[model samples]
Target chain A: MNEALLAELRAALTPARVRTGATELGLYRRDASNIEGSAGVVCFPRTTEEVQACVRACVRHEVPFVPRGSGTGLAGGATPLDHAVVIALTKMDRVLSVDAVNRSAWVEPGVLNLDLTRQVAHLGLHFAPDPSSQQSCSIGGNVANNSGGPHCLADGVTTSHILAAEVVLTDGSVVVLGSEAWETHGLDLRGAFVGSEGMFGIATKLCVRLTQNAPAVTTMLMDFESVDAGAHTVSAIIADGMVPAALEMMDQLCIQAVEAYIHAGLPTDAAAVLLVEVAGLPHGVAADAARIVEIGTAHGARSVRIAQDEAERALLWKGRKTAFGAIARIKPNYYLHDTVVPRRALPDVLRQVYEVVERHDLLVLNVFHAGDGNLHPLLVFDKREPGVMARVHAAGEEIVRISVEAGGVLSGEHGIGLEKRDYMPLMFAPADLAAQAAVRRAFDPTGLANPSKVLPSPAGCGDLQHVPEGAWV
Target chain B: MIDLLAFAAEVGDAEPVTITGLGTRGGAVPDVRVVRAPAGIDWVQADEMTVCCGAGTPVDELVTELAAYRQTVALPAGGTVGGALAVGRADARQLGWGPVRDALLQARYVSAAGEVVKAGGPTVKNVSGFDVCRLLVGSHGTLGFIGEVILRTRPLARHSQWFHRADVHDPSDVFTTLYRPVSVLWNGSAVWVLLEGHPDDVAEQAAVASLVACEGPPALPTGSRRLVPPAQVPLLTGGFVAELGVGVVHHAEASDAAVRPERAQVLDHTVRQALDPSGRLNPGR
Candidate 1:
């Protein structure tokens, strides 16, 4: 059966674009995640018509197909379980059109997030969502994951930025889910299609909403004696009626590693540091910057320093987004958990996160968009260590539980893919999950689309999954 | 307290149900077992900048409550929160704020199966699963019975002023001249600009645009709302008030032209089938 499906896929899209060899399948089995799955065949499709053909071929062969973009997802969303067909979209990269008058652009799904922003910079507008992997991550992946970054605190996530999407449904039929106009009548399938983690379908062409650049931008760094102090300062800034363009926090462990990697001198001794940015008109930005500094000082900040020039501002952001890359300096592997709690609960959540890490005997780094109360607690450890993976998973579960208990969701942006599928029950009741499953079935009734990624095993009859014992199972 | 289960029970065994808010949207009330979502504010998280309210809560009331905390939600005036959401209306401030969907953080609704289901989190950034919350925003109450909602709030601007400019060759020129404007509205003959920011900032942009201070936004003759491509809004002709940069125009009188089609797409039929297979929710919505 597998051989027959491979032959059909190779026929649908010339053999040069279809690969069933063991080596190619090995590379397509997993995303940036640690867990590994199986891939039956990998097809590189370059156009919307080609993508539709691939889906049609997979459906006829009765094989599950997963849409992949750069494979930068950390939650194993691109992992093709059940020997699924991998429709890699890296070759579809292109900026198709730009409507500068309406502040909207049409780009292929494979266009990198940062590349889209850079391509439209001359027009005085840029794409909003900036995932940490923006340099390499595709807009298709951002659409799939509903990705968010530090700037999402001020701007909405990918869903709000995407005005429309041309999606190939599971039945191999192409449909335009939204429109270029500000308002689209009828059910918002476009909103439902995005962030489905490939469960609904694949987005081929995207009409992305471009954000106008602010006239003034100010980036500031504030150091605190302790993580608690830094957490409180975040709350104080928000309480002072200021939502900056971006507000990020980093612990000492993260500070040390990032400084070592970039040599930017990021207060290696301070227990916590904040990187805050506010941008708007010059007069408003000045007032916002001054108020943020005042709030930081009121919360026992050691010093609040403002970046004098654009170069300094860019360097400060570089130190923040390069945080994951700095993990290699401390440990060979890192298991990160993305959860969000109320800003007032940040200090307590951080304290519990530290306790859990210590009890598990793991080194950790903390860096995340603190303004939104999102937490990215990285449990750094060596995988070669016996029984270390088990402890890491256990500690991760505990962190998620505490965040939920503190009126938080399971994830802020990474999504409930393979990483937190089981924990979904902790946040949603049975009916809620059923409703989500029904929505999934609405778009992909056959369930030939990426299966067992977002929903837990046996969400409903429509989903096809070979239920395993655990994450690696 | 609102009993979502009760609403679901009322929808027992696939009986058609229609949601009704205050009579603010007066025309012809659908004849059915009308179910009104809960009314009044549930809680206000001032620090978190979020507010939870029953869907039927009056917009003016919610605005007043949020004003106490010096926060605001972008909702059209003179309607229930649910009424504004049912028709998918957004205030003109969306020029500065984003789409109304961005503020709708969570929703609790009743499925056709008499099941109480919820989507989204009260938190600002949530991507744990499919965004059913936003999907329900403009569904016209066809999918489910929207009971309650959680909306993100923003700090009230320090200063707000409305200005008018006449003989404006184009609204685009007026929009480009302002550094950061809350809204720019244009009728057939005149343009209106609303600026919200620090007094100095608003004053600076007003001077740059050379707009005369006005008491309020210019009102146009009442008519059906028309939606066109944002770029094509300039082509629209009539006694109407059009939101600049946004493609919505309130025309002077009803037009025979149909803006949206009546045919439902495959996904629409599929979602309607999946959620309300028995056609229990507002039919033909």
Candidate 2:
């Protein structure tokens, strides 16, 4: 690290907020993606002004920087680069204000996703984007990923709920994109910025839309003899014009793992299970739930279990959210692939996913947002086994290719950070990639903000670099 | 279309180029050459609740075509598909549906340098890139010309309207009490509520609303302006219509207030330059 640059950073922010010790740098190096990278230093900014000051110091020193929230991103989006500074925004967690009339709240980027819902639950309103890691992930991270959850099937993603953001640009300039109003004139820069994966700049504050709590909610779990049956049921429910608040699916492997770990009452004998929830007025919710149950039964559901109370409902969701973590009981390491296909193509895609993994001699478990056809196929492997990692990577790539071939996307919620950066070409052509790079250059002309992520480093594209092998899991 | 691309490439380094679609939003550019949509390119294709159409297709014609499938775009009646996407406005029934941008599943457009670029795909849920499909929406033709768009459509709602004359202050209560109204419009002196859904559901919701409202002499108000934040609806002195659930408001009279684009940072300008290096497309709009 440059001593002069360190001094400048220390001067801009208090010495207590700036840390250069190896221990501190190590703590900020890795995220939930399990990818590790080295950092020059980690600075925790307590306010937007402090964040701006830290950015300015990096700009003046010509040092690359990465802004991070809770570091819960699964895509290594918050991973730091070697010789770069990690500006962690954890200390800036605070809800600035809540406008119940407008059904919106102003909060710092570091505010945890679920904390916002807890704060406004008393007013009969809540934030709708409930990612599996909502308890630990920051709103800023959610915005960075445009995070989606099961409820996103009906409520939309994080970008849909975000009203505006106060962002600190690369040169340390502060600009507000979007507004508290429902709509804004000019370019929808806020829409562009939300899912940029921190390449553009750091969002200091976010004005997020809040949704009213439904007067009634019905949660149910249905078991099927085969994955195709469950998938068909999902398509049938949607085709019937019933939009459930949340619809998720877990395969036999995922169900066995969750049942073994938490005893969530999942049927161990079932080939697949669909967890469905509907929310609205009492009559509407009841009607929708009945219709969903009818459809599931028609599609060969072995059994349909409706939650008798909120506690049971919570327990059911706990099983679904912890399905990823429960996979730990099966394999020491797993690479979760996020992709989406048309609802009608779910069955065909699942078969292809199974074939790819089977050919590789890998055990892959399926748990995903069924309503939106966002599949999370977890490839389970033991890294200690010789050549297992290579097989996992190949299978993961095949799944992505197949999903895109089925008219889906490279990613659904987890962003195209270091993990999927090179695979972007599978979904986009050279000209499309160049257009996106232009957008990135428009924001970070210096290429000093979260470099080597999102768009690939095309030739002569400024100082953009590739994610080093050290940054991979 | 190939000729247009060739022309654009020929003039890549010259002044910015303007793209015109049906010439609906405004007349021809003052000083720039306008590239109109090619002949015989206006077409619409619908499949499984999704519609893909050329940018030059008029919104009215597209709506009529989608009506055969009992589907529709959540955009107003006028303007071309490209123009509607360029402006990116949400209709009065936004509460039941969504904004125009949300309906955009995929798009293909020509950059100022004549490179045909595509973002997103023909899928309902996609998070591939930065969602360039949405980024292009409401771009006001500054970035590039929207050549084609694929949109997710919704089943047309069975429409019904109910009007009640009441001097209600702070109409937020109606949103809290009513159940899933398609639109709640306040015309200054009275409120006009539109409901659309299954006949039984709509009638039930309307009855519940009517119980709280006392019928009176009808009053008509004109020159309404739309506002977004429901909290700001009470602040507007004139009569306005508030889509209670959607948090959109329409005032009785138009206001000259404008959000200054100059407030945007250097990044926005940089993006504009990258997409239209020659500053040719809707320059300085």
Candidate 3:
């Protein structure tokens, strides 16, 4: 935020690239979430070297630098920390290479997720991990959070897709982890960095695996009388050995909100809805969809509707994608918590969450990636209320604890940024936390790169805090 | 070496002390402490996974016993389980299917304070707490020593095959091409392929591989072998369109002892220094 540091950053990058102007700074203040914060300065670096230069400058001045991509993150990951430097990687977007035979692509951090799929669509190849923000979220951020989409059940998460990376270390030294050439190497650094939440470092370029897009995509919408029924249908489908490309669940509140916002003709009266998509060869998709319908009906589904064309399928997804935004129309503010439980525990977890919501007298619109047990409970709260923020935070924390107790994780893909940093003890022990810290030290020893995230502050007590557990299954 | 000696003496009194075999390759590399066997000890077997060998038992001996069944003990044959797992290393191809650490379903080790600790169960998947079995695999003997490592074994492959696309002009091209045959790539020209299905399926894939390569008349490869690393395999087939330095190959082939015909030994020494700064173990120059 100092003028000297700003001048140094401007000197390293083009003056046009460094933006601290009120309006531009305003745009980088907050991510898609309701968390309010601001950055001291924001810079758009076009090249890896430019990013390194900015990093070095920040390192020299001891200014914390937070990497920001599309800012589509809902986990408060991209929300700027006060008095910190924000490195916006949007300008670094570039699809460097596509190796179809190898089924890999080396792309800059700023390339949009959807754009990668579009580029490889003609070749019958596509990148998996299609988060709802695929159209806006950057591949770099996806790598940072190890983002997972509804289709993650079949395609796997971002960590699976990432092959290698050109990372700019905290000290601004560029090092390549995991070669484009895959080997049974010394250590699986690739595995460690995938979900490290930028606490590791900035990934300048990524070598990610590209899959042969399924020959056909079949989408269907099924309605159940209760969220429990919908969850049961999911279990049945998985139990029957049918892995849909995506199995998304929506509560009545979510369906009503999406219907009002997108007008995609969702069943507003239904207690819960399941959006199912199957992609593979034509025969395989047809068989999978048929079996899915059988499972849904067996689990007490009230209705089933299959989309016939690409246009119809797009409309169906448009409604689901807009589900979070639609809640904003209902409430002035909302806190979205990403908690995951085991797949078998989906029905029970959903039931328990509903009970907790009722007890708190809060409206929680549930939308979950059912196949993976990733629940996105959108807690509607008016921030203006005296105790609303505290209550919402408490509810969010409770949801995370429940998932953990159920043998799940705090953030499946959103990651443990400042929002979830304090809750790390729920998922990891002191020694485990120390091991993760060791990895962080190997990458960013000074803790200058995106500090105060992932590892909870040392002052927090190590003793486990017991709370009302959420239903795992 | 001096630092390692000093630390070893300082912590010499500990039990189940973590000790590394070669102190090379990360992950699944066991760090073990020397524990004297019970005076009249026969064999101490907890489950099918691991057994208590003498403190001085080499990794190769342990691997042979553990993988004596129809299945293997999830460790690579080329190296000992202890040496293979020093820094938590796994074959990239086999990692998804499972890794050496995964096969270590249970382990019994002596703690620094000489307290015996048992981890994991006979079941293939156990996630009780701490995952000490996996933790010990690559801990480099920094924590508690690995007294005895219990590991789960899988049925070994009865029929295996090797394939080579001998005519490719460049080594790196193999990495670029031949995406299938996803078993192992060595030296850049020869691909060590393994088919683990029925005998008929193995024969079928061998026939397809020959057809794809346009190799000599099709036949089962009983004696033939290939050992090219995936990254540089294309180079063996005379595919050297782009010339890369010897350093890349040296780093990639860190484990293999076979020396290259054209490249000098300087690159290997450089790589050794880069990886093993302390020069504490496995000093094979």
**Model 3 residue B62 lDDT score:** 59
Q: What share of the true interface contacts does each candidate keep?
A: 0.71, 0.54, 0.01
Better candidate number, 1 or 3, judged by DockQ:
1
Docking class of 3: incorrect
Candidate 2 residue pairs in clash (backbone atoms < 3 Å)? B16-B279, B16-B280, B17-B280, B188-B239, B223-B252, B224-B251, B225-B250, B225-B251, B226-B250, B227-B249
TM per candidate, chain B: 0.92, 0.82, 0.52
Better of 2 and 3 by lDDT: 2
- Supply DockQ values for each candidate: 0.68, 0.50, 0.09
Give the lDDT of residue B238 in candidate 2: 57
Looking at model 2 chain A, report the run of 10 residues with the lowest lDDT sum: A459-468
Query: Candidate 3's residue-wise lDDT over B118-193, tens digit each?
Result: 5433332222222335445544544344444445444344344444555543434343332223243333334334
Q: Write the per-residue lDDT of candidate 2 for residues B1-285, one digit (tens) a residue.
A: 223465346435456667667776763466877765432233333323567777767889888887775667777667688888887877776665767777788877777767778877776666677767777888877787777777777766544555453676666666556665666656444466766555566667767665333342233333544545666665556565565645566556766766454648455677777888777777766
Name the lDDT value of residue A134 in candidate 2: 93
lDDT of 2 at A438: 84
Q: What C-alpha RMSD separates each model from the true structure?
A: 2.4, 3.5, 8.8
Q: In angstroms, what RMSD does candidate 3 have relative to the true structure?
A: 8.8
- Tens-digit per-residue lDDT, A1-473, candidate 1: 37777777777788999987889999998888776889988999888888988999888878999999999888888988888999999999999999886788899999999999999999788898988989999999999999999999988789988888988887777888778767777777888988999999899999999988998999999999999999998988887778899999999999999999998868899999999999988888999999888888988899877898998888899899999999898899888788999998999999999999899898889999999999999889998999998898778878989999999998898877786777777788778888899999888888889987777755433331333334521
Query: For every model in order, what is the iRMS?
Result: 1.7, 2.6, 9.7
